[model samples]
Target: MATPNELTAMRRAIAISAQGLGTTSPNPPVGCVILDRDGVPVGEGYHLRKGDHHAEVNALTAAGERAEGGTAVVTLEPCNHHGRTPPCRQALIDAKVSRVLMAVMDPTSRGEGGAVVLEQAGIEIERGVLEQEALLVLGPWLHSLSTGRPHITWAYGVDTDEGHSNQALTELRRRHDLVIRRDGTIEEGVPGGHGADSFRVPLPALGDEPGKALHVLTESGARTVLIEGRSNEAARLLADAVDRVIIDVPGTRPSFSLTGPGAESAVPGGFCLSDVKPSGYRVRLTAERVTQDQ
Candidate 1:
């Protein structure tokens, strides 16, 4: 249960967490808000990239002495074990934050999550505040962890006209962590607006089993990837690796993937089409990978 002021701060934390979307791969995007004893927000911060300060540390630093006896609201669990930086739980303890609230626990956390460590330090703890909202950004990272590979999406549309831009494809690229294409071309986003900057992500060729793509994604910390290519080029990329198929149909073409160069190379499980909607001059067809149970 959260009070009105705390809920408002949680919403702010969620919004700031999305700022780390493309850059915080290998590490989940996290946001934090520090509230003084009077329940007024004193400071806030979001994790910008890996090897940078965790959200709690940044917010605590911003709040300074105001953080003592205050409340800390985080979009994700504060980390307990340290890798590149010091554990965030320890930072909160050092700040003497009286209470901590988190949307969800880190699935990768070992043993008892960070909540236990905080409780042991005599700090009050609560979980699952605005959880579903947090999952909107955290899902891909969790999916990547569960699937053992990057949550890959194949984005393509038929545009006979050379100059036409695919709105759906652009939206997908903007939402994804990395944009990759045939011939191993890769792009990643930088510290700028959403439109500019991209990661030069790489993937193995079609038959390169147990290839470098997964290792790079996991070891390097990218959680999602978008592959933009034509039908034939899609065939050349790994068919089974894709988790979702995003088809873009221009005003001229009625649909896609039905009669294309890569039609023969379709994955064994095929795809389940959903959400047929229009975006500018194109109709977007979002398809989920049909698993055996479906």
Candidate 2:
């Protein structure tokens, strides 16, 4: 059983993990909170990027001597393997943390065995504390690990005539691992500071689909692909590889519809409205494809 303090710390760790979404591709976003023996949080940190200090290290550094005999609540299991940085399990052991609470297990073979290492150091281990909630932050990374492909999302804004652009969509682009555009299209550059790699592919040939382009991108290790545009190429992606759709409407409309021939067919079977909320002056709608297994 998880104590309320531990659960709250794990939630904080999950929120901090989101800070690395666009920046930490190929690596899962991880967060950590250090709590003193009194169960009061002493330090909090999140992994910023590859080759940087991990969340546990940063949190431990912030806690300093307070980390000894404290609890470490982390969004993902502490890494055990040596990568760009040293294994986090060793860091926790060195910090003298007495207990560890992790929301999710590390799915990768290299990332496994950390809990064992910690347990051997005489640290109390608690797994699956708020596991489902952690998935909301770790979902795309886990999906990429499981399928060997990046998760795909189609985003665009609808205008009265020419489709307008949404700032939220622009921010989302920064978080993706890759951005896809049609060949010959002039680069307008990313709206905000860009973090994702960009690729331009020729339109899918007749009798072919845009999924082939996605395959190439995913093969290059793109864990989150953003298809942003209103061109025929974007339309074809909607028909083929999109896993989710995000639309920004100018106002509150009783109903919504996509305009184009075969637009309805382009959506994956079993897609249903998953979210509708207000964004600034506009309304944002999200639809996700649901498989039977779900």
Candidate 3:
């Protein structure tokens, strides 16, 4: 059974995991909260990127001696393999943690699952405390793993200048693993500079297949790719490979229109509006591509 405090800690860990999106590509975002035996949180941490300390290690460090006999609530199972860092399972055992609560299993095969290791060390383990909510943080990486391609988000707007100035779009670009730009558009080099890699693809041919360039990016280990462009380019991507779309509508207008060559045909089969939220002064509408079966 999961205590309310444990569930709350798990949710907090899930939110912490999201802080690593766009930067943690190739590595799943993970978060951890250390709770004392009385169910009081002692420390919390999130995995920031590859080559950084795992969430468990950071939280344990913060908790220090208080972690002994405490409960660890983590968004994903502790990693048991050594990659850029040592295994996290051993860290928890070394910290003398008495119980573990995890939302999701580690899907990669590289490491032995941490649950088994922790159990062998005589720690109590509880799984799936808030699996669905945790998936919101892990979905993109899991999708990329299953499909061998990055999850694509197409971002564009009708008012080019205003769209480019939208804070949300700028933030999205900074966090994504890669940004796709039409050749010659970026005068100052990539928007994210060194934080993210950029790819410039030629303007779409009338019947060019979508995803060719993206496939190459995914092969290079990109898990989230953002398409930043004007309407025509967005239309081209939507007609082929974009998994999600975000359109920035300037002002508080109840509705906005996209006008340009192929703009009317941009949504491929169609799209399902997922959310409409405020982004600074602009309204950001998010939609997912509707597949044929749907």
Candidate 4:
């Protein structure tokens, strides 16, 4: 069981992890909070990008001598293998932390598990502290790793502020690492952020389909995309790519698939309107693909 303070730290860690979303592609957005010997939060940090110190290192660096004999509460298990940076497990061991608390286990961990290494180093280990909350940020990257394609969401009429009133809009922006518009406009995910300049390569021509646009995003190591455009144009961008659909107003609109009529699909599973509710002056509809297990 996790203490109340630890649980709170885990939530804070999860929130910090979200800050790394768009920039930390090819790497999971991870966050860490360092608690001093008395369980007082001394420092907190998040992974900003690859080739940068991980969340643990950043937090540990901030914690300094206070980290010794303290606890490290991390959203994900610390990495045990050496990458661009040295192994994080070793960092924890070197910090001499008394205990390590984590939410999810790293499926990509190499060699001996970080937990095993930590335990061998005389540090206590706690797992699954707010795992589901941590998954909210990790899911997209893991989805891309498993499927070899980015998870796509098509949002209609929710791009502009005065257009729709729904909480999903905020959630969409927070989770999506990439944003695409059929009109060749780029959404920076954040207003006044880097926008299209974040992409490493030139974007495809306006006439090209979303597939070509996706290739450029894939190169940026983005694992999830949020799409915005008009009906048929947004539909054209969706076609075989979309994994989720968000409609601001209920209507009898045609499916976005390139195929005609009953053969409609955004992806293999096809999307089904999963939820509907009122939002301000309009009804919001959420459609998601039915996975194999579902």
Alpha-carbon TM-score of each model against the true structure: 0.78, 0.82, 0.81, 0.77
Cand. 1 TM to true fold: 0.78
Q: How well is each residue in 180-201 modelled by candidate 4, as lDDT tens digits?
A: 6556565545443222333342
Candidate 4 regions with alpha-carbon error over 4 angstroms = 158-175, 185-202, 205-216, 232-238, 250-287
Models sorted by TM-score, best on top: 2, 3, 1, 4
In the range 121-237, model 1's lDDT, one tens digit per residue, is 999988999999988788778889888778887766655322125544555666677766544556663423222122334454433543554566544446887777654354344
RMSD of every candidate to native, in Å, equals: 5.5, 4.8, 5.0, 6.4
Q: Model 3: per-residue lDDT, tens digit, 1-294?
A: 999999999999999888877666678889999999899999999887677788999999999999999999999999988887899999999999999999998888354588999999999999998999999889778888887887877777756733756456567776667666543132111232222332222343323445675555655556777777664463464446677877876654567563645333433347887787776776677788786787
Worst 10 residues of 4 by lDDT: 260-269
Query: lDDT of model 4 at residue 89?
Result: 94
Among these predictions, the greatest lDDT belongs to: 4
Greater-TM-score candidate between 2 and 4: 2
Q: Model 3, residue 54: displacement in angstroms? A: 0.7
